[model samples]
Target: MSSILAHNLHLEFDFSYTSFPLVSLSIAFGVWLVWKTWKLITISRASLPLPPGPVPLPIIGNLHQMSVTDQSSTFLQWQEIFGDLVYVNIFGTPTLILNSYEDAKELLGVRSQIYSDRPRLSVAGELVGWNRSLVLGKFGERHRTMRRLLARSIGGKHAQSFRLHEEFAICTFLLNLLEKPRDLKLLLSQLTGSVVLDVAYGHQVKSGHDQLIFWFRRIVQDFYDATAVGSIIVDMIPALTYLHSYIPFTSFKKTVATWRAHLTETIEHPFSRVKEQLRNGIARTSYVAQHLSEGPLDFETEDALKYSSFNLYAGGMETLAVALSTFFFVVTKYPAIQQRAQQEIDNVTEGKRLPTSNDRERLPFVEAVMLEVLRWSPITPTSLPHRLEVEDIYKGYRIPQGAVVYSHPWAMSRDKRSYTSPHEFRPDRFLETPKEPDPRLFAFGFGRRICPGKHIADDTLFLAIALTLATCNVTKRVNEAGDLIEPIPQYTMGVVAHMAEFDFEITSRSDDAIQMLTAAHTQLGE
Candidate 1:
């Protein structure tokens, strides 16, 4: 009883005489609790309210309203209802959609350091092992270094060095198209994939059945399966990633294990081939060969080589094919666009010789058409998400740290403030004075995360569009009843949008065009 009395007296003395007291447990604990509460209150006052968005449901947030297939279109509708910065929460995960160029530019561009990081992709990265590649990997020294290496190889003018290979592929594509004009998708895939593979591993793809093409298709399908929005439970709730294996008697773990194995095979096979060719002193000049040739390689350097090579090929090939396919859709749907482009090409080439890389500057209208295609329908309508690194406030709206942010190129393309008649398909918009923002600026990406392979992809696309328009006429196919089968853009929108179901007729412009292709085939020794 005397000890208890003494303890109470000490607590009373501490509480009365000192703001900080180590002598009394109860008083010290109370002081610390008060300090923590004050800190939290201070932080709360500093941050403004979140950006406006549709009212979210409790606990589940906006998950019920999310669309798996048409996320961009849905976000676009929300942009109309809400403001440019639309905030959402999915199962406690915060998401912000920047529906205008200015918002995207201000946040994702001007403040790149705060917004450059990619969201953690639980299924695709952790389970399927794509985190080894830069696309799904975290941003850091490794990502920047790998991007530097890619920039050295193919970023800008270095892309011009691959013209011989590109021209060879284009010639083969044209020759095959002449024989089988209906094989649009097959021929275009071969063209884009072949160029990317050549640059990646020095593996030339001359046919549709090339082993690399099969590997490409496998990896692409696997990637889509792993990353399809609302498909993987762990991706939706990343905390569940740790518990995935313990989720009882399901083949989920085995499925992911198989996907992991396939990804390993796809990434390693070409790397092994390049090493073998180097050992025999017969290696071709390619990304892998060039990097391996420089004396010894540390583990980090070699790992960068392997994954960055895949990043280059995977990042570039699929989208180029889609963009090329969109070109066909655009020209077929609007013949006048094709005529203007063809006439421009004819004036440059004098209607005889094929347009080369040297003719790009002279073919302004062709470049405009290419720009318009990118703006008209961005393949990846909404960019891959960017994550905020720290809490920030913009325009009186607080953007929480770890919020997944997306810049909407689709909505930006249709902004009335930026483009006159935003819904119209006008290539001349690119040629006009005080030209609208170059879609290339936002199309490939923005800030530091922009595609390093943009130059090479642009070169290939310009050549293909110029050559195809110069040599052939794209028109709607006639049915068996001789009725014109008018084609509309039947887009099956997803992660990567495609006009996969459209049919159009491609035909040789004249006898001269056929002979030109024939001579090129002879030069190709095919």
Candidate 2:
């Protein structure tokens, strides 16, 4: 009986094993069906037309069509072929380029609630610890809080208090030009850095080589270099961040560690000094002082305030430096425009004194020239990237969530529909059509993410241009053969576009101009 039972059990096991193949086949068949369905769904979604763009290769996806150095021009060329909205992928990341003013306004401005978020910059923002910075921070409660604090501290009426700092900085620039004209670029950098320092922390920069200014300048340059599109591979392909430590000399982890250390010093050192001054009862009214007066804040809020206030120097200084450089480049390259601008300044001041922001209303031509400068060479050509928070469609084109949107101010400024002779640097164009939209609309940026320091920047540029033209004759450098060496207004390839180094001669317009600068310097006791 026991032998029979064992035989029966063996037979049952063999029978079950014989049927296993059928069950296996059924399971595999179900998996295949599910995979087929998923693939079809994916294909259907992908068939939705992305805005017209160059045919992309599998993984790179139009990366070959891009130039890391001149991305703005490349985007403009793509726009010519693809239309106002051009979609491309940077290493699997979807990017939307807005080449027209209307498109930019509709998407980045009008739809800001969903489009105001900043893209994650793995290398520049996260690795380098710049995520704390208001400019690079994500869109959230923290960003909103920082923006609100910044608006109260530096936007609109609050910005007016910085006009005196701008005036003083420009006055010093005028005097510096008289003594060391060859250092024009350095002087401009100092002027911008000094004004922002005074306004943000009530810290006066003693000279062009002030220790604080030096660190801030280095930090700004590095930040731009790190954040510029395509500068770091890890930024485009975030997964590569994991491999950063494994790479040899190409390790972004090591590079970012170094940058992070310096950035901490850059953001915290000055802020600590300001706090110390406040503790010692030697504080001056400034962004930091005002915020500190609000009482102690949580670590997160305090960090936000520090970074937000630092933005005055970080964002304002580099941009204004570049703008002032472009102004010099433009005026010197086109002497007739320079002459016209100088004539406007002369008329406004009547050669009696240095032009001030109080005379800004009367100096319409100078204002137009400033507008033209902003249009002709936008500092941040592709204003900072804005990311989408939700899926959206416009004009029958799909803009998926997480798409990085860039407003092409450089392209929009050159749009033929907006300005006649758009390529020409003509201030007269702005004067002719007072109703025409100013480039400042796009130059400073769009929506809630627009520059809060716009007022201070505008006032600083206006006064600097007015004072420089009123007191100095900016012209091309004369060669040994006595020929005028005209400057080619080539710009540096970065977010903050500055004119490449060029030779120029700046001289007092007349003895009266010299006297005016001298008197102003004496009044400031410089």
Score residue 5 of candidate 1 by CA lDDT: 100
What is the per-residue lDDT of model 2 for residues 18-116, given as tens digits with 9 covering 90 to 100? 989998999999999999999996676666777887888899887888887778889888988988999998778788999999999999899999999
Q: What is the TM-score of each candidate against the true structure?
A: 0.89, 0.88
Clashes of 1: 0
lDDT of 1 by residue, 246-304 (tens): 67633466777888888898899999999999999988778788888887888997898
lDDT of 2 at 66: 82
- Show the lowest summed lDDT stretch of 10 residues, model 2: 228-237
- Best candidate according to TM-score: 1
> Local error of candidate 1 at 320, Å?
0.7
For model 1 the TM-score comes to 0.89
Off by over 4 Å in 2: 1-48, 228-231, 236-250
Error of 2 at 183 (Å): 1.4
